[model samples]
Target chain A: MKIGAVIKISGLNKDFPGGVRALRGVSLEVRAGEFLLMLGSSGAGKSTLLRCINGLVAPTSGRVELNGVPVGAGVKNISLREQRKSVGMIFQQFNLVRRLRVLDNVLCGRLYYNPLLSSCFNIFPQRDVQFALSCLERVGLREKAYQRADTLSGGQQQRVGIARALVQQPQVILADEPVASLDPKSARTVMDILREINQQDGITVIASLHDVDLALEYARRVVGVREGAVVVDKAAVKLTPKDIENIYGGAKEQEVYDGTYGRLEYVRA
Target chain B: MSELKRPVLPPTDRDGRRQSGLEKLLYLQRALIIGFVLAVYLWSARGTNLSLPELIEGFPHMADFFSRMLPPNLAILKDLVRPTVETVQIALWGTSLAVLLAIPLGLLAARNIAPHPTLYATARFILNALRSISEMVFALIFVTAVGLGPFPGVLALAFHSAGMLGKFYAEAIENIDPGVVEALEATGAHKLQVIAFGVVPQVLPEFIAYNLYRLEHNVRQATVLGLVGAGGIGFELITSMRLFKYPDTAAILMMILATVTLVDYLSSRLRARVI
Candidate 1:
């Protein structure tokens, strides 16, 4: 019942309205303290699988057990909000409230702990504010904390998002297409932060990625999904580009690039 | 993984022969719509008895009316100040009260934030009912209930604008980035926290801008509320016009114009600075 493996997804199924199935009998057991990447083509159910893990997307059938607590609609073992507290999430869009200061955006991670009446007025406890500031420092963004979220570069914004998730002190972090919107350089910075956290803090990460090079470079384990089903699950070190391409329905990328998601690297002839 | 069967895309418009048959049909459809609109306008014009000759014939009468009001009676200028200021006060109080009323109702009505379908529908119904009834009608009712004063005028403006402002706020909330909201919710922030952290920041600028616009609009509407005996400069102007004191009426009109323009200037400046 205590935290053991971070995630256990069993026979998970999700169907959107109009009977379009996004996930089909997907099952995964994610141990605590590891970097795992899910790879698939667009609409391959990678995002849905991650969302299901955190209870963002309710599975139509099957189950997801987080820290041994079942999560889904109509299952009242624990409240959905309470269950979500132990799981952090990062998004492709960076999802920071653009109008808020970076520090305020980060502080939102502690909103659950902050009291309802005072937090509604943007007043937080001293400890929460300090922790939010420290989270910013971890991302190397303490200097930018007071600036509006919109004022930062895309990469910096993503870093702020990572810091916000880190403040949750969660058992696991689920990143859904975290770098798809960033420039290659920015993408590297964001990935490096995620990797650093996973290694140094022993926090589990289940990230969905579209880039083969990035997944191979950072993830120790990779799972491939094809048409809403888990097709390939293996160690990343064992994967060839061809293997990843197979997950993508073959040869998705013609040109090779650096690990920063398609930024061209100089080949030393 | 097996051999990939890729989707093949054909190059379009190879000969550059402009658009296809669908485009021609679309243009014809647009033309027919314009023709239909023009025909409706012609039909409407008959109902209003609109005629160029009638306008020409009435030109002299309009000129004669203007001639009677040439010299504005400056004697009544000091007396006008009290009522004019009261008009502005009504608008100020009404708009402030509307904002206070709108914020909660707006949150309740917004589809994304509403806790239940029934709550959203009820909030929407209240807002619509308030909006559909004109402020003039509201003033008439209030004036009857409160026995005629600027209090009734203020109440009228506040109720009507609460509806308008609430609708605007709801739209602003609904249109915001849902992604940001999801980011907060995933952290296990409760409903109010999600709104405070995720929704409020995104819509604050729009809320302020719209409120300023409502304040400016309310000022103009307040002046007319006095025509229903609900206290303002319009009450004074009506008395002058009925007494055939056209010069006094002209003076009140000029003061009203000046006051409206000043409020307009102040509202725009505040909007520029804040938003």
Candidate 2:
């Protein structure tokens, strides 16, 4: 099941203003069609890593190559606005244009293909509209196409976010805490959708999750991160209790899975 | 549980003593500020002919003048039709032009939307310069250039309102939810696409609301533009007063008031629909 690397990150370092170092000498390789789940606590640099891959955050000192083409802010990667086309993103906040109809928000995914003047005038091609409608159908939001985005529930909004990303037609999808703001049931629904998309479409899915049990159930590969470094990289089944502790910030406790998904109760060791 | 040893709050007397000193200082500072204000007024009012008695003595003369203007001549209503319409036209065109100009200038001046600091600074400076100059001054300047007409009046109102509208729009843009724009950028969309799809939807309602407010404001301002010979009801008012045609002046004033009131009502209703 070993596929060629689709994203090659080398020595990535991101130092924000006020001297806060978000990423420190991080390096990673994401293989094609790998269901890789990044396990980390808050501020473990997972979000920054995901952002760097999609060219949202520039590395202070590193290289991020998507399909062997360098990409990031100021990297001169994609000429003529072709950047980040291969990398789709799902956000924790869903980030939909709230006042816009769900269909229109989905159509914005095709903005990169249309010219500036036409898109500015809200003139998307007919094929693009059909494609967007299909994407909404895939996410089970075809009935909600005309409703304002803010009117949707959290789970529905995330589904719409998925539809928007699908409209981008990317090779890999980066979901940054995509279920962090969702309820447990909604979390399971979203994870199921991502798993299906990954397995059925062979599109790579990289997700950052704090729910250890859900990650174990859905992800084939687990990468444990601690303090901006990848401390454990192994097949999901191969990870030991120690790896779990490392992912959970060395808490020497047996993490109880609380029967239901998305619930973890730690018993101190 | 009873002997949990309640944490002793730190003694407040020491802090209170220090704060009492601070209070005394604050009181002194407040007195100094009030005294400074009083001194400024006292110094500045010395040569301004501040005579309440003179004003009281002049009030009877004002009453006599007002009595002569009683029962406004409704005959001038026919003549007032053109200039009043021109005043409204000036307001309509001026607001439209301001909206057109403000959209781009506001985008450039907005701290979040601006692509570069230099462009942001330049746009801010331009808007500030325009806002600093009053419409009266702008009308005088334009009247000189275009040689006295409603065109110059429109130009004056547009330039001045664009400055104000642009600032308001920039603030609206700056206050938008950034997550939407970030999502747009994540999809390989260009900057223009982000603005068009993300920023516009969020801010457009507020922008339209601001435009309605500006249009209502501009209607009143348009009447003043004719004071500099820019062609409106203001010229009629000023000329009637100059020639002591008090009845005609009252009619023109009423016409201006009615027009302003009508625009105010319509603009508010439309703004309510948008919001």
In terms of lDDT, the best-performing candidate is 1
Candidates in order, TM-scores: namely 0.90, 0.91
lDDT string for model 2 (A88-201, tens) is 889898999999999998988888888889998789999999999999988888999999999999999999999888888888899988999999999999999999889998
Q: Which regions of candidate 2 deviate over 4 angstroms?
A: A72-77, A250-269, B1-51
Question: Compared with the true structure, what per-residue lDDT tens digits does model 1 show for residues B19-81?
Answer: 789989999999999999999999999999999999999999999988898799989999999
What does candidate 2's lDDT look like per residue over B92-139, in tens digits?
999999889988999999888888779899999999998999889999
What TM value does model 2 have? 0.91
Lowest summed lDDT across 10 adjacent residues in model 2 chain B is found at B1-10
Candidate 2 colliding pairs: none
lDDT of 1 by residue, A1-269 (tens): 24467688899887765556778899988999879999987778887788777666777899998777787443655777777777889988899999899999998888877778898899988888899999999999999999999999988999999989988888789998999999998888889999999989888999999998888899999999877789888999998767766787764542221122100100000
